[model samples]
Target: MDCMFKKIAKQGGDIQFDDVETIIGPSVKLEGEFQSKGNVMVSGVLIGKLETSENVRIETNAQIEGDITAREAIIAGNVHGNIIIAQHLSLLSSAKITGDITAGSIAIQQGAQMNGKCSMVATVEPKPADVKQNAASVMQDTTELL
Candidate 1:
């Protein structure tokens, strides 16, 4: 908490977190799944899944190449995977993302570059086909007719 300790693998650092804020140092590389119950800030290279019960922030110059799921996310980096945010998603000016995204709300900055599908909704419902098949069975009244 004093000097902001950096991750060991990188000379600079990979990720940083505190009671309220989290920072991912520049250019550091991480090769594994990451899960957090609090907010997270990424400013390095991550090659795995990222999940957070709280908000996730990806700063400029960061690169994440895996699935990300969170309550909210702010991306200013480069991501090459699917993202599912339960609450909100923000793409800042320097962000470059190439993956599908689903969130309750979304914002993309002027200079951001995203090449993927995006969906906005409070909750994700099952596909219509999946639901329709079940409906057909429910209408079967063989027992009642007998």
Candidate 2:
């Protein structure tokens, strides 16, 4: 049991995979939001949002029904919500996406089905207090001048 625990731990908690980079199985189903600090490979059905600081890889047989917020995402399955990626997004041949996508880079395979808008954008940092204050003051002064 100790060895089994160790093996499972190495594969990332309760999720099991033959390869750390691959998630392939038929009977898996996940519900509710999932937050991961590392990469995620999903081959099952997920009914909630996926949040990852690294990359998210969804296999061809997988189905996700909620939003995805990640640094990068590679999808080969079905997605039904908005995708907000900081870096890159790729849709493979079997992908079926039905919502908007915002990412720094994107790639769509030939046979993929996509029905949404895509925007290439950079990550934005919040303005510092000084900058915000200065801008507000400038705007006020301009309005007064007008």
RMSD to true structure for each model, in Å: 8.5, 9.0
Best by TM-score: 1
Kindly report which residue pairs in candidate 2 clash with one another. Answer: none
Which 10-residue window of candidate 2 scores lowest in summed lDDT?
3-12
Residues 71-144 of candidate 2 have per-residue lDDT tens digits of: 76778899999898887677878999999888877777799998999888878233378789999999999999
Candidate 1: deviation at residue 80, Å?
Answer: 0.4
Top candidate, metric lDDT: 1
Candidate 1 stretches greater than 4 Å from native? 1-18, 124-146
lDDT of 2 at 52: 79
Q: What tens digits encode model 1's per-residue C-alpha lDDT throughout 1-146?
A: 33333331212233333443556668578889998888787878899999888878787778999999987677878999989888767787899989988888787779999898989998855457979887776667655576
lDDT of each: 0.76, 0.75
